[model samples]
Structure formats: C-alpha cells, structure tokens
Target: MPSVIESEVLIRVVEPRDLREVYEVESMSFTGSLTYDFSVFLFYYVTAHDLFLVAEALGRVIGYIIGLIEVRRREILGHVISIAIHPLYRGLGIGSKLLKALEERLTSRGALRIFLEVDVLNKPAISFYRKHGYVISGILKNYYGVSDAYIMVKEVGASLKQF
Candidate 1:
C-alpha cells in the first residue's frame, strides 16, 4: 500500500482552487495545534503563491506546504509557514517531496536558509525535520498558545542536501 501511494504521488504548484483542500489537510495535520484559518491561507496565497505547493494522488489533494520568502538583514530567508499531509498519506514520502519542492523553489529565488516551528511534543515531526538536515535553533514559548515549539532551520545553497 505504501509503495502504491508513493508511486502515484505528483507535486504541483498550489492554485486558488486548491485552497479548500489544502486547508482541510492542514486542519487534519495539526488537529491539536494552531492551524490557520482560511483567511490566513488566502493572505499567504495572494502574497506568496510561488512558495506554496500541493501534493496529489489519484487526482486528489493529499498534502501541501505553504512557505514565505523574505529578505531579512540582507539575507533571503524561507519560512515554512505550514505543511500538512493527510493522515492517510503518511509514510508514503509525500511530506519529504513537498519539503524538497518548496526548498528548491526558495533556493532558486536566492533563499539562504529555511526555517519552521514544530510543536515540541511532536516527536515524529521533530525527527522528520532532523532527518532532512534541519537543526533546532530555539524555542518559542506558547507557540500554540498552549504548548511550546522548537524552531528548526536548514541551510540552503551549497550545503543543501537533496532527499
């Protein structure tokens, strides 16, 4: 089953029409965490569409990643604002593919580093980020208004590792 899911995965740019499904996946992915509302997704889509991506399987949206790139302190930084793979799609390499796609897009736009915050208690997510070469940078207290989060960063450019 895992092999079959992996084989049919397709990565593509996020379109306005995909927003609903994207939000649905996000809601599912971060059930207890702070998932953004539709309005927030719209704001990001309008401003940072290039950094948004979605993964599809059998023509259904199965996962997505929303990112933002900004030039801060003269260094272009990419922030993984949100990423979610439907629970059913877990362990099929979709998350890694989505991350790689977003990183590649950011790198092409001269981003020097990529960062994201993960719930401190989500060990699987923490491990996943580490596996992709992201290191813990700091902690944000009350990141979800109830729990803390760890900021993880991965250097892009020449040091970026391909999955």
Candidate 2:
C-alpha cells in the first residue's frame, strides 16, 4: 500500500533549478567517496536530461534518480547511475516511485535491460532491488575501492512490475 506521503509526492523530470536540492539529498544519503560531486550531477543533467528525474513534495526536492541509455553489442541497456532520497523520506515509497519512473522512461527508449551497482554491505538496498525484480548477476571486487559491489540486473519487458 502507498503511504499518504507517497501519494502526495510528485515525480517529474529534473529541472536545472532542482540540482542544488538534489545535491543536498545526495550528500545526505551518501558519504565519502560514495557521494557524487555537484559537477557530476550537472553533467548528467546535460547529457541525460530525459533520464534524470526528481521527486518533489511540499515544494522541495525529496529525491532524484539519474540513468543513462547505452547501446552495446546490438542491445539497448539502461544504467542507473545514481539514486537517492532525503534521509527523512527514505521509506515512504519515494525511491520506488523514482525507480519506476526511470524504468518506464528507459524501456520506452528501447532499453532491453536495466543495471545498477550496490555496495555489498548495503543489505537494505540489496533487498529493495530484489523486491523490484532485480537479481544479482555478478560481483565487482574493489568496486568502491574500500569495498565490493553487487551488479544487479532486471529484464525490461512484460515481466516488469510496478512496486
């Protein structure tokens, strides 16, 4: 079931003005090397505007998800470059909303599969992805320098379901 807050939250394409608030969410959600610099967000905004989205509630940016579409070996793939919800909004279904919106956009753009990397130690994230129908396909050692990461993938077709 969706929470009242989730129902109130609006998911939309990210605007240039939302970058700062989006960066704040990113900083709050991650630390050290895991956090992306503001420039990286700007780059994504320029290069993948259609794939960048934000969750707005109460007139502020509460979360954001950035993705990229790539063609490799005759396959169109979607990559979730980054996703983060403000600490206060973590469990209200905002992340799921952001992810669902991204997946829809990617699939429409011909993405046959979606991929993301999560730290091996992040159990909550692993479980979240699993619930969304993603499966761990492999592991990348030293993915985070100080830690490893699990590469998870989900096929984008009739099997995809909404959270």
Number of the predicted model whose lDDT against the real structure is largest: 2
RMSD to the hidden true structure, all candidates: 1.8, 2.4
When summed lDDT is taken over every stretch of 10 residues in candidate 2, the lowest stretch is 1-10
Deviating ranges (above 4 Å) for candidate 2 = 1-4, 161-163
Candidate 1 off by > 4 Å: 1-3
Candidate 2 local accuracy as lDDT? 0.91
lDDT of 1 at 22: 87
TM per model?
Answer: 0.92, 0.95
Poorest 10 consecutive residues by lDDT, candidate 1: 1-10
lDDT of 2 by residue, 1-163 (tens): 2234778999999999999999999999898999999999999999998899999988899999999999989999999988898887888888999999999999989998999999999898899889899999999999999899999999986656644
Per-residue lDDT value at 154 in model 2:
94
Candidate models: Cα lDDT each = 0.87, 0.91
Model 2 residue 60 CA deviation (Å) reads 0.3
Q: Please give the clash total of every predicted structure, in order.
A: 0, 0
